[model samples]
Target: MAAENARQVEARVPPQDTEAEEAVLGAMLINPNAIPVVTDVLSRDDFWRESHAIVFDAVRGLYADNNEVDVVTVSAELERQGKLERVGGRDFVHALAEAVPAATAAGHYAEIVREHSALRALIQVGNEIAEMGYKRPDDVAQLLDRAEQRLFAVAQQRRVSDFLPIRQIVHESFDRIQSSQEGKAHEGVQTGFKDIDDLILGLFPSNLIVLAARPSMGKTSLALNIAHNVGVDQKVPTAIFSLEMSGLELGDRFLSGAARVSTHKFRNPRLLRQDEMDKLVRASAQLTEAPIFVDDSAGLTMFELRSKARRLHDKHGLGLLIIDYLQLMVGDTRAENRQQEVAGISRSLKQLARELKVPVLAVSQLNRGPEKQTGGGPRKPQLSDLRECLAGDTLVTVSSTGERVPIRDLAGETDIPVWTLHPDLRIGSRLMTNVWRTGTRPVMRLRLASGRTITATANHPFLTVAGWARVEALRERDHIAVARRTPSPAEPLDFADDEVVLPARVAEKVPDERFRHLAESDVLWDRIVAIEHAGETDVYDARVPGTHSFLADDVVSHNSGAIEQDADLVLFIHRDPTDETKKGVVDIVVAKHRNGPVGTRPLAFVEEYTQFRTMARSDDREPF
Candidate 1:
């Protein structure tokens, strides 16, 4: 049978010409024949494993009522039906196929991968060229020529060595076949499964996407969102290795996503409707068929994650990989340094993206400072906000007001908030990302819910240059301004010795006189609009010397013996607006004086005001 198959194979070989002979000799290898082996179609169990499952499924897809493998015929039909186009024509393909000797267990493909310096150099060159970005058409042609020449040598060599890491070949193969063409090609399965699809697609794959925020702002929800899209919608098989959550919990989230129900709301099965149950059942059936694999492998090190990802890719053509959160996993490399461990994890993720050529997303936590209560707008998360997990591609934070629009922040060098949702999906009548600057309250301008993906949008990521420069200058002045100038030459005359020439908007604002003003008499205050009392803000406030209650001195025409509401030697203690830490609780201390002192000395007491901005309405606090 082997001899007959060998003859049949020999009959299929094409004659080689002299011109082809000089370019390179395919590694002088002999073609071996096929052998018949018995297999059970009616096996003990109807389960397929490894490569056989995908290959056989594709074969089954090619079958028409006839039960036979008609690979060539289907390919021909696809071409005829305009589903595919023949590249370099059939003759070129045949010639190329003839050059490749069949691989055997002893063929040593791995070694070929290991020893193929030419292959490595070609890959390096390709990556370097890619990094160079778009080149002129002629240069592109030259690059293609160089790339083809490499394959020509490989074809001629006709050797499949075992040393080649399967992951490398898989990645290269995707690039060669998919990216080499002009238009976009979509991978069929959304695997909610893997990162390989997007990786092989040759797009920008981000390594770290920190989804930091106060807990329960849908960090896990968005991770699942990406995972589901890449796996199920994109058909890129994926791996989700979570440390905090069990596999079941993660799967439940996917179930919620598939069912279009809120994850928190889906906690109880008994409350689910009949339709929901039916949907769950259908989802389960589909999920069973889905290529998106989950490994709720807890406590994975960076090394283990990579190793597992490589195996998933090599064995089942994995497409994407996701790690729930970064801080959970520790690095395996025996480094005593915590930063090194973190750095190692970050570096490995970046390496994984490059090596696997897919977006390797790992969620991370934002530091304690991000627990801000917003007016429900997108707040531009900063790199400093991500200083905790700043080692990767981009710092991302997620914030959602349950029913409000969800915000995903890249936290670039500048404050740029990118919106991830389709506006139609938002819960509000007006839908836009509510992104504000990091330090500012969700106020005083500069909020836009623009940009898409981690990559910055063309115009929406930052304030205009003028605005940025002006704000920066103002900030610098706030930072370095010695005691407020007393009518300096740059300043307009009539300026109070300490009054800053505030922006027109601020000048327009009506200041509460209760707060102390940083001022000297205004004599040369020409350019300056108005200098009254600076408004109490979280960054600054006038605190009286001694009580939780703020002291505002408004001398009434009449005096009340109730001893209430009038200022008793109020000593304003405010924070520098530039002080990052003390800003949150800028206070005013009013040294308290008890009126129960007919002949005795006045009782000196203390009062405290918790926040600065709260002082603006201190008058509103029922004067007890």
Candidate 2:
């Protein structure tokens, strides 16, 4: 009974087989041929005992150096490294060779050692995970990701896929082709555009497709149209990670496209006609049954995206995954530079597509290179432009529940409560998901009808009468929304007196009571009096995901790229500069197609519906 109990106790220890470790080392010592076979599968760390590990390391070192690896050579190597006595000397080394029955079982013994090593690694990871639980890490998603990575590392140690025979791979390929011919296997999910579908075949599984364009080029609109086709039309479960736009805004776009109504009507319901309203109701009812899932969570990290996607896939089965612009998603924070971080993100996205066995459509933004091109009717975007793709120095101020706070100090802060506008132009409180400085840029100052002037980047979008429009798009008479009442924070204004001509600087010139009077209030429309250049200054933007817009200097502002190498298909959207209304022909340039032809396909942008439709001809005419 005591012997049986002792055996059980031994079994309970971290999974390790001392006898297998000895056999592997012994087989290597006996047969010179076994050295190559053993070394391929087993590392020094595979041995459970310290002495056995030391001996194995010595043998491996000798073999690596192209020196003879036998009992004598291994023992001499260990001794040279001052580890002979520590690993039980020559006597133990000789015993290892004598104990093995035959060298033929070296591969089997090595496999046993590898299995135990993996188990031991698993135990170590379990312990680390338990400690992590006790510590109660702040970011639970990151902690879970770390735990999953640790377990996968152990599994990967034992997993190896040798090269398959060409004959077998050819048979598999033929089978797939036959199944596709018989309509039993699909080439890929249809992208809803006949020209796009024909050019690249379809959005194939395990492929990363990048859709890139400059700002206001309708990148989001085109992506949404394709997503709608796949999800609502075809009944394929689609996951859209809208890091920039909110879920409600996406819904509005979807409704507008489906009903063939103008998106402007959705934002300003007063403009909605009875016929359009009927179309929207019917469209909403039809789309209510669609298998589309949207996660409008702002500033999502790569790990969080993977975890959520895996869970979503496991539960409802995902056929397609779309990320609205890849550059917005972050990778490992420890990356040395922005370039490394983006490259890591790109690689991770490709891996994600392969792992999930689904098509990943990632929207990308082009750098300012296209805009700076001279002598151009319309500068066509290139795949290389994806490597590039910020807002102004205004002291940002946000108010919540009648309390005023400086937006500058809130950078990097999360879950801060603030009021934001919804798609229907209604003001509601939502947590500011993320806040960060875009960059220092030449700002444009807009003087409001109330004599309140605010400065921001030319590309920064504000809540205008005709929905969100950038500073460059805003005209002198265009009415922008602002808070109707000043925030009644208990603290008085403390801005230092300066000649910087900033909004903050203007605040210092007024009395404490007057500053409070000019503080951010309820939502009201304010007309633009004058718009002019305000030199250059540091500008900040906040991400309020569900609303996509945030209060900046008492006016709503829209919160504002990457590796193309891993992409199997690279597409660029080219809208003519002269088509300022964007209600015209846009070219979908297939810049890089790994398995097919590359050319431009013209698509018409239905401005009212915010949808992309196939062109009638190459002359840039709409089919409709």
List the global CA lDDT of all models. Answer: 0.36, 0.74
Model 1, span 225-305: residue lDDT tens = 556666665566778888888888877766755654445546666777788777777766756666788777777766567
Worst 10 residues of 1 by lDDT: 550-559
Please write out the lDDT profile of model 2 over residues 479-579, one tens digit for every residue: 78765533344122232223112223334676565433333324566778899977656656565544555566666666542256679999999878665
Q: Which candidate wins on TM-score?
A: 2
User: After superposition on all CA atoms, what RMSD does each candidate show versus the true structure?
Assistant: 25.8, 14.7
**lDDT agreement of model 2 with the native:** 0.74
Residue 536 displacement in candidate 2 (angstroms): 29
Write down the TM-score for model 2: 0.51
Question: Residue 282 CA error for candidate 2 (Å)?
Answer: 1.7
Total clashes in model 2, counting residue pairs 3 or more apart in sequence or in different chains: 9
Model 1 ranges with Cα > 4 A deviation: 1-211, 261-268, 373-378, 388-624
Total backbone collisions, model 1? 71
